[model samples]
Target: MSKWFCILLIACASAHAAPGAAPADDAVQVLNDKSLLNQIVELQHNVAEKAQSKLSAVGQNVSQTAYQVADSTAELVISSMGFLGLPYRRGGSSVETGFDCSGFVRAMYQETVGMLLPRRARDQAASTQVIDKKELKPGDLVFFNTMRRAFSHVGIYVGDGKFIHSPRSGSEVRVENMRESYWLKRFDGARRVAGTDAAATPPKNY
Candidate 1:
């Protein structure tokens, strides 16, 4: 009944008829043409149904993946938050001993998502994929040049333009605004873990 179906029928009928000859009035021929049209219409309906089903399945998969990523990110951020006020030890990576900047970032990822990151700040930056500041999401890493070098310090971004890190010697792990004057001036860049599902396999060098 669609315009395309009508056009197809006309095209088929024209092809079957001889050039410049009138179509035959044979009853058998009419029945055959009708049968062919019905088959074609049924085939098109089936194809459309299959295509729609496939699209629906793909949409659901995408939504489920996105939800998993968001859930993983929330868990990582919440786990990091629980470590607030822990002392900043120079090379520490545990609750009993405390943690340094990169150590804290590495510990949270390992604990929450089972993903291990590079030990050093610079190495962590090199191992992950680079992303712009505006593209930062919860669980992404934010780098800073705290010690006169790129990526000397790292932290886990907790969204809303804020990050949590273990500041130097006497300070403890705490959240700070990236928009603050000192932080903004020292901001190096942002990097995202390779996988959205928070199950990224570290690179050989990572």
Candidate 2:
């Protein structure tokens, strides 16, 4: 009777021990779940950091471009104003050799703005954007008909309804008002030079 009781106790103990020894697959599954969760959390953190870096870079580029545009415009105005007393040559286009009416306009753009305008005043007008006299701004081109022909003369508008130009053979480069009788009578049109690798491409709002 005592031996039968001992065997029964041992059998009960063995049954409980069998459940405590878990299967290998169950243990592996728990480990895998923890690893996957950790990986997901790390990935999200990296993506957020990269997004912030890209946004910062884009903002810096826009600010730099805006500053460059303002700088170029100011330089163009200063360079044009420097040639106040140069003589007018028939087909001259540089400060070193003087400038013709069209040449003066062309040289100012090339020297200050670093753009080569079309040689003829008429072609220069045609190549650029046509604007009304009322919309004239500094660095814009103003056309005239001094020789009884359209666009026979051209000058650079220098704000305040005034311009700088090389008038004729006997005259020198000078600033004159567009309101003068001779210029006002011959005013054909106004045009702004097209962006040719200078002025940062202006932003167009949608």
Candidate 3:
């Protein structure tokens, strides 16, 4: 064959390479660049999708947090109510042994919210995040100076100026109205568990 024919055959063979056969160096470089570009485009698309997913998850968290306060309060109140009729005991922390006012408050929070509060009423008051009575939610604590001392008593505020507590030695766990003259006079303050006000403050990004 002529030289020209041989060159034409080689060109055709190069253009129509067999499956998985090694390509010419120039052709291989062009294919590699095209494959690399496709991979880059796929990576960019994947990154965008992942970012969108994260933003969606964050939005869901904000929504859940918005309702968390009310949910937690309701759960706490429900748990406290479950202990009604249990007799009072000094420094007691369980229904089996009975419960003091502070112990009742502590146990209720621990059971309902998985949070450990200070054992004594006064210590709990000092350690918690104080809030005005007007800001009280159902699960917030209401302090009282029943023993002629600051924070001698504590109760879980159950909304509408109502609270649940284990009264004195003779009484059992009970829910009472804070508006009653007896409780009103001794009302010291109100407080919230730290970081439980997520509903009031939402994430800035969302």
Can you write out model 1's per-residue Cα lDDT over 1-206, one digit (the tens) per residue? Answer: 35676564445444433334444333123234443334334433443444455457787666455445545665676456556666789999887687999999989888877789999999999999998776765678999998999999999876556677888998777777788999999999999987642322221111
Off by over 4 Å in 1: 1-56, 59-66, 197-206
> Which runs in model 2 stand beyond 4 Å of their true positions?
1-58, 196-206
Determine which window of 10 residues in candidate 2 has minimal summed lDDT.
197-206
Model 1 has an lDDT value of 0.68
Tell me how many clashing residue pairs each candidate has: 0, 0, 0
Q: What is the lDDT of residue 150 in candidate 3?
A: 93
Name the top lDDT candidate.
1
Query: What is the lDDT, from 0 to 100, of the residue 6 in candidate 1?
Result: 57
TM-score of each: 0.65, 0.65, 0.66
- How much lDDT does candidate 2 score? 0.62
What TM-score, to 2 decimals, does candidate 2 have?
Answer: 0.65
Compared to the true structure, candidate 1 yields what TM-score?
0.65
Pull out the clashing pairs in model 2.
none
Residue 52 error for model 3, in Å? 18
**Cα-based lDDT for every prediction:** 0.68, 0.62, 0.65
